[model samples]
Target: MPPYFYKKRKRGAVSMNYSQAVNWIHSRLKFGIKPGLERMEWLMNQLGRPHTNILVVHIAGTNGKGSTLSFMRSILQEAGYSVGTFTSPYIETFNERISMNGIPVSDSEIAQLAAVMRPLVEKMEEELEESPTEFEVITAMAFYYFGSVNKPDVLLLETGLGGRLDSTNIAEPAVSVITNVGYDHMNILGDTISEIAAEKAGIIKKGIPVVTAAENREALTVIRQFAAKQQAPLYELGNHFSAAAKSRGEYGEIFDYAAPSLQLTSLMTNMKGRHQVKNAALAIAALEVLPLSLSEKEIREGIRQSSWSGRFEEIISTPKVIVDGAHNTEGINSLIDTVQRYYGDKIVHMIFSALKDKPYQEMISLLSEASDSITFTSFDFPRAETAENLFKAAKVQHKSFEEDWKKLLLQKMETMREDDVLIVTGSLYFISEVRNYCRKNFLEK
Candidate 1:
């Protein structure tokens, strides 16, 4: 084994198998979501302070963080630069949280990184009164993996929770990017957009350039104040940079993007939604603000090829089976807008589920506006809301609940006519399950 795999803690350190390591990390959820930087600081100090060694693009937002990061990563990759990313709520595998380019870190690498973090995790639990949460542990692992081992040219870091107290905020990033700010985690982040924007603006470091795609005036005011206080240059969407959708279809979008230094018409993306155009434009603006060298061709091709999982992804074309991870009101609104644009004439049936902590009721109400029939379903997650509860909350007439999502989905698809669309959405976790099921069962056939 390489010395850097475990760094200086190779001696007397406990070695854990992959499953044991992952389970140990997930088990930290018992401590709940303790949001603070003190424990994270102490853990990083013990791990040789690796967070300071790498260049990062810090991204914090409510809905578009993952997709914006994907666009930026694909652009950088298209420009022939290697990129590392840190995102939360893994859709496919636990290792997906820490990845290079688009491929997740190998299981052996995860085992090695877990081995390095396990001892430190134990030390923290013994020394500190409050143990680290699951997010903090994963942040530590990502820091260990990227900051110490297999470092990439650029690391795109996404905040797990609010930006100020988020463990990922410990890193000093070259550029601070906020995809968009909206009402989410109201209990922890605050109830209003201004307060939430304040939390998102916490990532803007002193003298670092800040770029935002937030469209709300209240949110923009808060971000502007924060950036000005930090003396950070601010490049805002619909101001310094903008994107206008020219066309949208079931498979893709074509848009026009413009910035002070660059303007390109008819930019296209495989990813659906007008919001995606805004995300791509924000990504390009962030890259422009950075010191990296990139061409217009790379940016165009990146937008065209970049694909994000669990964000309006089409699973099977027949009956037009689409799945999206729209758990919040803002996300549902965006999904509905896309639906109206593409599937207004078609019969759209939306199957939904979400975490108990989210604003699932309002989300369901918003979803009912576009969906012809809404099916409420729950997954095997600790926080997932009951299908009956979601169904009961729906004010719309065409609504039902099913404990078994597979049966509901099969029935929906089997009964749908050629002009109908079946959408499975609610949470990213749920969409990932549906995505895997469809890939294994329908895509294969």
Candidate 2:
């Protein structure tokens, strides 16, 4: 342990209720996405390096990280192993970021964890003259919870941003999984696929196995080089392991998976889109490479049980409403493919809202291909693009803007014909809001 890891801070425990704790954490958003690990390293050190004792499956990628993590978590749970997962950009509640057996950290646990972090964060600010970002703070909480509070058999750690500099990168993982690399965080990661791939490959460690579904040649080459440099075994999706689609089943995507150790047919994911199949395949490959032995039954049952919300998630049945978290161009492309394949015959109405930082123009352009009728709408977030600004990105025949997403959703839902499908796309945050509204007003009723 580093000498500073034992920084004897003369401080009292910061007390807080649930709301106060959450608000305090949210207030750190002003620090923004400062992409570096100096703060995390310092904070973890002060916390006595709680992350070292835990076994982690460090997952990094632009998009599929959450879905892949869910697959692994489900399978491990099915195999009767306790699994803890740390993921970002929660689809529902803030406590969902740190979970065990798919159950979110409790409100009391969240408050307690926040209390543990408050003092350390204050100490870091005083010593380093810098505040940790919201993500960094949460990563610390996960480490503390899983490390000191309750130690699970394994932890699925998802990088909040780029792998190398993300707050969650301190973990010494048993296996490193990169779902895929793409151009999402260009400003922080880099402008090119190679740069981004290298950033994602930062989780690679000596002798650790790497599993990736990255198909882009440039991205794959960068990943291969990083794996070689680290002397880690590389498992490419289409090369070392592969998932071939059999059909889009009633529940989700059905496919056949093949890897060096095992091969299985009719492996199904309970999430829509072909990309989900790749995620499930990556999950299987990642688990196979882990130190534990997972049976074929566990793998199949686990993948079949796993479902990620806000990714091609269908919220309503009649006059079907689909909510997808396709904030970037690559994700938008996948959404477009799913739409064309499933709702091709229906008259699709697309609602989109994204953060200003995302490639909303390209995303809007791609949504146009999936549905000519497009409506741009904004949500209650700092980075959310204004509905009018999002409207400017669309070049479709039927395009409009609505400042009130609820009003638009209600108007569209009430007026949808029998052959119409309503899709709410764009930012995960926006979709999260939409999902909550639907659950309260429609699904619950």
Candidate 3:
């Protein structure tokens, strides 16, 4: 028997077993070319639109959406509302994409849900004569699960690639948030900032309120036009709300935020980097636009307690192994700025890799300015740039390159004294390999 068949037999004669369901998804799920609202509408219509009962918050942007969603989820949960959050391109596992009340769905629950939905999805595929994408299936599963078990008071839905065609746009959101716009997914969205902003602006529904961070003039114009056409209330960060850093040090950043209805001062965030402060501000602004009443004390407490891992995350502090998922130009600039601001004039050893589609050359060119040495590595993905490719790129910039990242990293750690920083970045996928290497070699307990 085949591997999947063998596994199914081992699990006993269940028609749609866990392994089988996973296999089915793997076989059917594909990326690219599928766009528009028709597929999601059809799926939801088939399922009776369970999202109508759930209070939804739609977040879209080229960057910072995930971190902002994290901040919002923490605050809402702290304020005693049951919350379900869905984010894409998970750092570790597929199950990480869906969370209920800030906890990931149980593996058995995911398996059971996949098993139940597999047949229905397949039937839909045949009946409609068009197969649903991987994202659509998982989205449907998340909506159904959130409705059945958590029935959350609020749901934070982050757009996958772009907003107009993203599966998460199906929800009639109570509030829509645009973190900021930048150049990414140009192949699908568009090449220009205005075109991309128009795609993201699709999440702005009629008569709904939108909270947006400060954006460039071009992107803001597109968003403003959309809001005007839809008659959605727009709250721009600097105009309608603002946050200023009260104090920042090695501990973390503390900022004061003035929202429409609430003023929170000295709100300390555990997340590192100055850009995180901006993400917090956007989350606070979103909360301000909501009808739910929250005291200043509650807002302060929520801001102080919000945590989002993998954004400038420090895994090991001894040799100072920092991992950040700064794959784009804007994010890379933020990471470089943060490192300089915190650890000034210090030499940084960088371990880097990126997806084939990303602006890897641009990212590397910027990073080369701050990095002391570069170690090229490959991540476990089909589209990941090979270590050899990265090494060649580093050579053009006259930077030192180590092709065997594992061996080279161990060598560096053994030779370097304290005070030197080691940064593992470029892609979140590579961070896992770096972490595993550290755990086996250096980290104890």
Candidate 4:
């Protein structure tokens, strides 16, 4: 062997610095989306199976998963338990993906954990003859950090993609939650609702309880088949439990949630939209199944306190700038419902962007119905579709394209009246960037 290669081998897999560790993990992006449990299983074994030690509530869905997880985390924390949450496509920073007690993991802690896992990861790669993907490594990081170091009482694990082969599926969660089945990730997940539901239902473990808010017949059938096959008791929405919105206004929606063992009247969720009622109810249902001692007062207080940023997040009062990460059809429809319910006939200006892989046209069409004016814009991401492409796909007449999204948004907002609304949405990646800018430029002031 050459001297350089021999020296590299001699150095061995040592712990890396923070920047080095992040870069090394990002470098695995080239490995792409290799979905399977084999790599994660191998990695966990090398890490002494830290995931096996933590109590997890595994959540999967096309939308509402993050919100549901947040609601549950808040409730759990209110019940006096330390909670760890693992979510994807973070709104602000990478560290936000792995959080303990609603606070993101510190940078130094992430670096330290990365260093510890580096050698083991390398050994696994060498043995498996293939490196793990970026998500797989991050999943392992969450499992190790939460299970070993942070030691939370419960971990809320959200699936990154399809549930069946997702890296996060390695855990045997106490309960599996599918918030709802929707048409997203068609390229990898599938083409139809049933196909997608089957993939999301993959999280259902044998003898474990499964909870879902999915209403579609096709989707429900798949979930039913899977739960029956796995012998997992299924608690479904609109049947096992239900939430009805009594009143909704600018403040928030008041709803009544009822399950067999628990009932709460006039529960309020800070998260706007009727869909949020269902999300909160699913959180309650999952909490009900767990053998934890919780009170109705704590659950109500927790749901009120729990808030997920970038989902109908109102940033400014005047001109009423709201940002929602409605990337898929179901989410966009929910956005439309909220907009119509709250804003009424007010003039609405929409700023939209989506990934090339998403069904932007369908989403644009649905959004157009709710907005008076639409501006198709692009974000600074590799997968972001250009403004021109989105505009060409748009069928709405009151639509324009703007490549310089920041300048366009600012210029447009300055021209808005008091009652007019500026709704920024489409892709979560796009929403994250715009939301950060809006907070610094608008909210901080």
Per-model tally of clashing residue pairs: 0, 0, 0, 0
How would you encode candidate 4's per-residue C-alpha lDDT over 165-203 as one tens digit per residue? 999998999999999998998988899999999899999
lDDT of 3 by residue, 1-445 (tens): 0124213422322355556666766666564447766777776775567767688899999889988998888788778888899887666566778888778876666676676466666667788877778877788877766655457788898988789888888888999999999888888899999999999999999999998984689999999999999999999988888888776756568888886567777788887778888899999889777777766666677777777657787777777778888888989998898888777778788878888888888888888877877777775677888878777765445455555667777776776668889888877677656765666666441
Better of 1 and 2 by TM-score: 1
Q: Which pairs, if any, clash in model 3? A: none
* Each model's lDDT: 0.89, 0.88, 0.78, 0.89
How do the residues 1-445 of candidate 1 rate in per-residue lDDT, one tens digit apiece?
2556675677658777889889988898898888789989998998889899898999999989998999999999999998999998888889999999889988877778878877777777687755888888889889878888878899999999889999998999999999899989999999899999999999999999999999899999999999999999999999999889998754789999898799999988989888898899999999998789999999999988899988988879887898899988999999999999888898899999899998888998899899899999988888889999999988898899998888999998889999899889888888889888888887532
Clashing pairs in 4: none
Of models 2 and 3, which has the larger TM-score?
2
Best of the two (2, 3) by lDDT: 2
TM-score pick, better of 1 and 4: 1
Error of 1 at 265 (Å): 1.3
Model 4 quality (TM-score): 0.96
On lDDT, the stronger of 2 and 4 is 4
Worst 10 residues of 2 by lDDT: 1-10
Question: Where is model 4 more than 4 Å wrong at Cα?
Answer: 1-13, 443-445
- What are the TM-scores, per candidate, against the unseen true structure? 0.97, 0.96, 0.92, 0.96
Q: Write the per-residue lDDT of candidate 2 for residues 303-400, one digit (tens) a residue.
A: 99998888898988887899999989999999999988787888999998999999888788888888959998999998888999888777667899
Q: Is candidate 3 or candidate 4 better by TM-score?
A: 4
